[model samples]
Target: MRTRGSLFRILGLCLLAGALVAGTLLPVVALAGVVTNEASETVESLSAELADEPPPLVTTITDRNGDPVATLYDQYRIPTAAEEISDAMKWALISVEDRRFYEHHGVDWKGTVRAALNNTSGGDTQGASTLTQQYVKNYLINVIYRNDKAGQQRAQETSITRKLAEARIAIQLETTMSKDEILVGYLNVVEFSRQVYGVGAAARSYFGTTPDKLTVAQGALLAGMANNPSIYDPWSHPERALERRDFVIDKMVENRKLSEEDAERVKDEPLGVLPDGPDKPAANCVGAGPENGFFCQYVEDYLLEHGMKKDDLYTGGYTIRTTMDPVANHAAKESAEQQVDKTEENVANTLSLVKPGKDRHEVVALAANRDYGPDAAAGQTEFALPSAISNVTGTGSSYKVFTAAAAMERGVAGIHDTVQSPSRHVSDVFVGGGEQCPTVARGTRAYCVTNASEGGSGSMTLQTALQTSPNTAFVILEEQAGMRAVLDMANRLGMRKTMASNAATGGAPDPDAESAEARQSQLEFFGPSENSPGKGSFTLGVSPTSGLELANVAATILSGGVWCPPTPIGEITDRDGKPRPLQEEQCEQAVPEGLANTLAVGMSKDDLPGGTAHAAAQGVGWNRPMIGKTGTTQHNGSAAFVGGTPQLAGAAMVFRPDRPYGGLVDGGPGNVRATDGDSGNMFGGKTPARTWFGAVSKILEGQEVLPLPAADPRYERVN
Candidate 1:
């Protein structure tokens, strides 16, 4: 109805309104473009940093039962393949995190717009970042945390600038990595709880199961926990965890990913988390239980000394199974602790058991009255050996067994060979150019040795002399047998060139002694170290040896001269679960089978009726065909018993009262009596022999008893 000029004015005003709206929107559109471009640049930089290189995996060690003994790791991650991730878990994450994930690129435009509108409209501040953006952000946080403080700060800061940058990077990342790759990256790096950084760890730490094994309820529960792990810890807040879990289930049901009936059913189910979750396994011998700690530590040391890469222990995912018989080990421990006198600080007694046959593998059962550690449970000054291989005691009369074998090998004597032993001998020890025996000062250049029983028995067979452990006969026997033959025989039976564990028997000089430097300055020949024991008294049990080494020697005789070097490792597997080649067994025939059998007969239970180790023949209850010998070094400072059956072989030793560190693991110094509770002297023929009997009896408890060869044919053929 108005005039034409009025109509023009109204049209102009409507046009102006349109112009104002366009002007208002232009800056916002342009601003979005600029922000997206900047975000893309930041994402590009971050993508280059995230190589998706997973952290080191944990190396688990298990026992014979596949029970976990130890777990070695810097980060406790048990990585699994993506295929193991449950579909239910994936859906739970998608429903909670990115509803429009499949349709959108990495940035999820629909989600971002909705979130922005809700935030501006006085609603909940929704972080509509897609899974891809979340993954990119987490990776950036990881990279920045390790190497760049500024990058970390920017990643953590809550600002529009940061959000835009993450979106651009997320979009670019979508073009590079597939959806699954981004999802896996997210699963591996997402922090589920304190000291626990991945969904794999979360499943194990919370549900005590693997990702593939997760049920719908458990999957949803774990995914729900990822929201606010600190405030809603399943372990710390069971009520909160239940509430969040139900919420996730509701979301899945609302999305029709899960049926309403199934959702309701799972909602009422308990969290079903293991009470303590995953048990953190101990990593080393220090925590491998008090009973097995020393043995574990010994295996660790033995591997390093025998050429295992030390660093591989921590980084390599190796599954190493050892040759330790827990039954035998426990038996030996019980015997050593019970038979030996605990009252004496220096009265150290230990028993070792070895089973080495072509059929049955060699296993070391090294057990002592006191644990292998510093300080004794009852005393301050005790014999504490740092390693199972450390030779803390002398070989003692056990060395004579080797001498007898040497004599038979050279055909100088037979089991029935006859000799008349004199109370005293004044003859030069025929060493040729080798070292001479250290003895008391006498008028003659030759060493004069007397018998413990003055006026040596008139006439006795070689077996009789051995059974009596008569020094004069053995010395005379050694003179006829030749020292070189004995030395070679000992070496073949697992004796190292350097037989000294310390300076007591002329080994590497005692550094604690003023004369240590001079001793270390001594010349070396067969041994790498000058600490080698003196040669003169080699047959008199002067050489130092460990119980494990002695066990090898006895096992040689038991295996009919086939000497197998003691080994702890049964098998080793690499990080990739491939079997790694271990050192081959170094077995050799040190003596003829006939000679070994003959010696076994001479030291057999029947033979012991007239032998020094006769008491060993009378075992507590076991009647297995056993052969053994008793040993006592000078002044009875150390005693030993080496014995074995066709199935088991080993040695037991006891140190003198004055022998420091020989009886005490770690204790204040004290003196042990020469005898035990019943006034029984700590003789190798007594306590050590008793310990051996008890130990081997337990080892052979239910095994079949075997018989020795009636007579070694080689002995009959001897002239």
Candidate 2:
């Protein structure tokens, strides 16, 4: 590796080098730390180990189409062969960095003497380090960082003792390795900028081209910047970079490497920096920027949960191909950033889309707007990630389908069953059915229930209840179906408690683990501290989940009840280029076809005025037959829409205003506006519904527009 201003860094090389060449160790023996005989033996030993080093490789990540999307690197560098580097670049570096590079053995005695005299004479101590010595110093530094940080600090010490050890090593390095090997090694370890190490990476970052393509003028500019990458930044300080470039060209003329005419001509040329865009993209998924950053994290989490090793991801040199559709991914990003106003704190949008099927379901898009990092939020560790995963507090009315389906699956109710309801519904059938479900309020036992105001008071059929998503209708249905039945249906469909660990949630899910009572509280015996939900509130979506899972649920219903848990990775290859085995396909028919179809029909009524997510169907503009549901929780804490066609399904959710119980957006937040200016606050039908609509519409643009399955005769409204 190369070091800028290295003479001061190598502590005491001059005295030892002079003494060794003079055939006497007495003058420098004490400062050198070893006797001449011992030093000679040590140098010989290091010579044999230099031949075993290997070139480092970088890992790649691509989309399902085999298009490169990002790279994961431990060193953020690419290794280049000595033969491939351009002569212009090679000469330019040699001309500016080490004039007597070819003439020197390990160290340049003449230049060394001249530097010592200059320092003794009180002139600024000039750099006398030959290219070989610098390579040794940089090598020592790199090796030390691998295991001993304290050694690195000592290696950088500007003391006589440190320099003697470096000189001794350079002596060994020069004997076993050829001059070209030393040059290549130095180029590979040089730090050109922050997290950017090596001439190869620097060339690509600044010029958008390989080292072999650099012109003489371009080569000089890059070489000049090596000493001070920050100060000579062409992007930020063009004038200073231009001045250094010209100075290097002038130095070449003085050294007679270039004729006066040639140097003058080169000096007048422009900096010729890479324009418009960067050749080197971000180092990994986090660097993919705000548009796809969230999904990149999703892909990472998926791979880790599967079989890929975490250590292998950043350094194992493997390639991973994921099933992310560019079209839908971009659509979701636009909907989050432009379509939705996410200016306030804790307000973010996450959208996930799935391809319909009974077997492996391809996840199309899992995108969010905000860029994420360790410090993404002011007081929270994460915001966008939680939203994409839908691991939040409540899902609201969007959860009505699970309760409705569970009742039908168990024969407690039919799509047309006229379940008795009321303007206000209480869930405490366990304690008292006639009064409001008692919940503690202001330190006293209180009874409570309220309708969405949109659902007028009455006994409602399953079809009407689903279309309107009324709190009362869902509560009545959940009570009739038995709490166990509703809880069983939700668990079977793959909803997990928000904070459960990944290992616990993944693999085959257990639908019956939580008895209906377990859904309300951690305790087996119901008590006041239970949160006492029972089955009635299950329809209200009290649990936390993710957009990808929810979208997969919509795809499940569209596929005639078959469910395929969302899978991100299509294939992965080891460093050896062989495909590695991944988890087996997880596919299940979680719901009965008849019940699933009945529920799908209610969502397919988007063409009707009361269909909660009608705008989503219209957004596609294809007139394709599709189905979905809208959800808005209490306090408007969260808004979500899960919509689907036979071929495509997606879910979008928005959390707003950042507080324990801040205002919510059912139709639309009064301040938030749509494409046409108007307050959006309803149910999941408004903003999030529109986002789900926009993404699915674009995702299914060219695919076949299949109609929903023919409804069963039993699906007609029941009295």
Candidate 3:
């Protein structure tokens, strides 16, 4: 209903003044297809015939494929002069709004006199301004020329002097325009609510229909809501709205606008409203756990990082074309949710999947706590950690996937490179002690061991260490690769973005600074380095990272080391129906396909029984194999499963946020349990695996999954 921005800008003279002024013209003279009439003349003539104009209103919602999901509006419009306006609406508006609508051309002298009398009486505030005057105030005045909050406030405030000025403007408008023209302007320019401006919005918001199609009772209701809408809004206050509507119907019957039967029928009709508006997520994932909430939060954060406004997420009326398929997303969520129940440990899980050369991705599943709330899941207080979707854990053993890729990409080491896994010492180790930590490999001088911790696998290749996820194996590799090399590789693979602690503001940070000795102690590494002292435990997957973080860690390998900015929105169109093109982000290749293949081949070891991901391999066919890893922190409290099909990459996480520090000191290790309830065996293979499988299967039901491009050129059997 509001005029286009360009048109408003072009005619800014009358609007420049503090008062709102609008001019209307009728067809008084016709020459060469140009109809001309004096604005004053149309306003001054009450008997002149007017052309019909039915305002257009559209409601549309589309799917990811740009197909119409739903539509609620007029399919076609056939205008006619005899198309009578609702008499009840006219009289209700005229009675309390403009009693002199049919009299005085546009300006009502008698009404103005009465308004002045009422003002002087000083009993209650009253306005004698006509509808034409009100339309001018809503559009021209509010749309332009106002500056500063005070100016805006003043314009909004209706007063006696303003009413008088409005009368003069209304008279001018009526003199130059036909009655129908004035009516059209009035219908178009009126403000129904904050965003519900004009009759079109009012129709949808209230009766859920277009203006022309409104029934007599519905028309009366809309007319009643014209002034002080909030008090009579049917959705918010149905009783009051119905009372006001009945008042309009009564007035129409009194004015002979409608017969007694029509009035009775319409007044008794039940009010119904159409549902079409933005639905905000309750907390994060719609009464779901933290894993989903966190992922949604991650998407929000990504948008913010890309310079999008927070308001846009809720009210921008934008359709986001995400790389996520709803089916896959639902499947993943179901799988993860179902899996979380199997684990007695207090934990959460999240998974994401992406396909090759496609914009559609899937967030398979996420479950934050063992149960939802206190006395809700299992009467456990440990479930109280904030379940917001952004609380991603630190990448534990999954970090090696990156480290190995970094070595391969930089040529620091090859998949065939020899490393002693059983050796006692290596580099950049963060935990464990001297003699007890056996040196499986010989490289730098910090004691390290396999993840199993029994003894080293003797001597093994770098690929073997990766497949086995040995603690000492990765330490020796990291030592040889150097911290700078490892960090460089991490940076290339989007690891910097995964560091939740490094956020600018509103992020969690260490409360107290560490002592000088503690800082020095933290800097020690297992690899031989001039900058870092040797301490080896880097390969055990002892680090921390969120499901998304680890998912992307695997995603880098899945994507052939080419990083693409994940997005939910595809294209944005303006009100004028013009598409705004978004720049396609260029891909950044972080590692060679050959190296990625080596890791993929090793990761495929999960299909074998001795492999960490043996559970995931149990029921799947050989047509499209699942390649991924299963990680468990020292305590059984946290577990993760990261894997993907040829088309998608996703990660699922499960952890106990409330477990006391290590929890081992307590007889039961507090929230960090190794098994669920009485099962005595709880691992990622159970719940996390089920969630991962369910989601993956549902998502890939009918879709084709391309084979992952080989990462190692030297490995002939990789394909």
Residue-wise C-alpha lDDT for candidate 3, range 202-280, written one tens digit per residue: 6555555556566777777777877776787777777987888888777777766667888888778875554443121
Q: What lDDT score belongs to each candidate, Candidate 1 first? A: 0.62, 0.63, 0.50
Task: Sort by TM-score, best first.
Answer: 2, 3, 1
Give candidate 1's whole-model lDDT: 0.62
Model 2 error, position 172 (Å): 7.2
Clash totals in order? 22, 16, 75
lDDT for model 2: 0.63
TM-score for candidate 3: 0.71
Q: Write the per-residue lDDT of candidate 2 for residues 1-719, one digit (tens) a residue.
A: 22321221231233234334423322353333444454444444433333322223356777778777677766566666676588777777788888878776777656655664566577876657777777766655553243458756755554333444456656555655667767776786666655566677767877878877877788888878876778987777889989998888877776777888988888888888777533576666756555656666677777776666765576555677888777778888777655444444556666888888878877877765454544545322234443343445456787777777877776766777776658875554633232344644443343346688556467767777777767777777777777666666665665532323121222233445564433333112212225544434456765555667777788888888887767777788865567877885478888778767877876666435667666555555647776767787765667778878887788887765234244443334324422121233535777677777766666667778687886665644433
Residue 466 lDDT in model 2?
A: 74
Question: How many clashes show up in model 3?
Answer: 75
| Best of the candidates, TM-score | 2
Q: Pick the candidate with the highest lDDT.
A: 2
| lDDT winner, 2 or 3 | 2
